[model samples]
Target: MAYRIAARHPGRLVTYTAETEEAALAKWEELAADGVPFEMTDADGVRVDDIDLEDRIDARGDGDA
Candidate 1:
């Protein structure tokens, strides 16, 4: 499974994948390790092009660590 990213900002994060959660996590950790921007919504609820990571996370950092 290919996981998508959703960054709350240019170099921030919010959430990640559950289906691709396992592998996607590696990328998330990698980005976070380097302070890169990224996030991901429930692929079921949103699409790649439609995901506004910054807006979503800004609205609710519900999945930040």
Candidate 2:
């Protein structure tokens, strides 16, 4: 599966495909840490509900799988 991070305001999109969720989350965090506001979604353009960016990053570090 592919993960996507897109800017909510201007609609900039960044797509990441990784062998594992951890790797994807890592890339997401890297982009987020740059301080741009973005929303996470799946490859099909569906929003990844229930998890905020920071929380999701934390979850990955905590091994929440």
Candidate 3:
């Protein structure tokens, strides 16, 4: 699973995927700091604006452990 970061500007939707919530949040914060507005969501398509970081981390599959 991956974290999805999407930025909507005018007529475009820019997106990126991150392997971990930390990395995803980092990128999100980076974008915000740089004045890029965006929304964050998890692999399950849940909005993460009010979600806990740990809870947003994707669980590994049986063979991915």
Candidate 4:
């Protein structure tokens, strides 16, 4: 399944798509690292919870994943 990441800047919306969930999460982390606020959608284009996603990333970063 494909995953998508969308970020809204001052006046533009940027998006990125990945062929797999892993890649998508990696892309999310990349964006987060850049300090850009973004939202992620599943294959169906349904937005996931930003808080949950951030928690997961934090867990991974803490070596608890």
Best by lDDT: 3
Q: Write the per-residue lDDT of candidate 4 for residues 1-65, one digit (tens) a residue.
A: 67788887668999888775557767777887888889888777777654555554566685655
lDDT value for model 4: 0.73
What are the Cα lDDT values of the candidates? 0.53, 0.58, 0.74, 0.73
List TM-scores for all candidates, in order. 0.41, 0.43, 0.66, 0.63
Instruction: Name the candidate, 2 or 3, with the larger lDDT value.
Output: 3
Weakest 10 consecutive residues of candidate 2 by summed lDDT: 12-21
Clashes of 2: 0
Candidate 4's clash total is 0
Rank the models by TM-score, top first: 3, 4, 2, 1
- Give the per-residue lDDT digits (tens) of candidate 3, residues 1-65: 58888987568888989888778878877887887789888889987762466554434334463
- lDDT of candidate 1? 0.53
Model 4 misplaced regions, further than 4 Å: 49-65
Per-residue lDDT for 1-65 in model 1, tens only? 34567656555455645454445555566777886655544556555322343344446546565
Which has the better lDDT: candidate 3, or candidate 4?
3
Candidate 3 Cα misplacement greater than 4 A, ranges: 9-11, 54-65
Candidate 3 local distance difference test against the native:
0.74
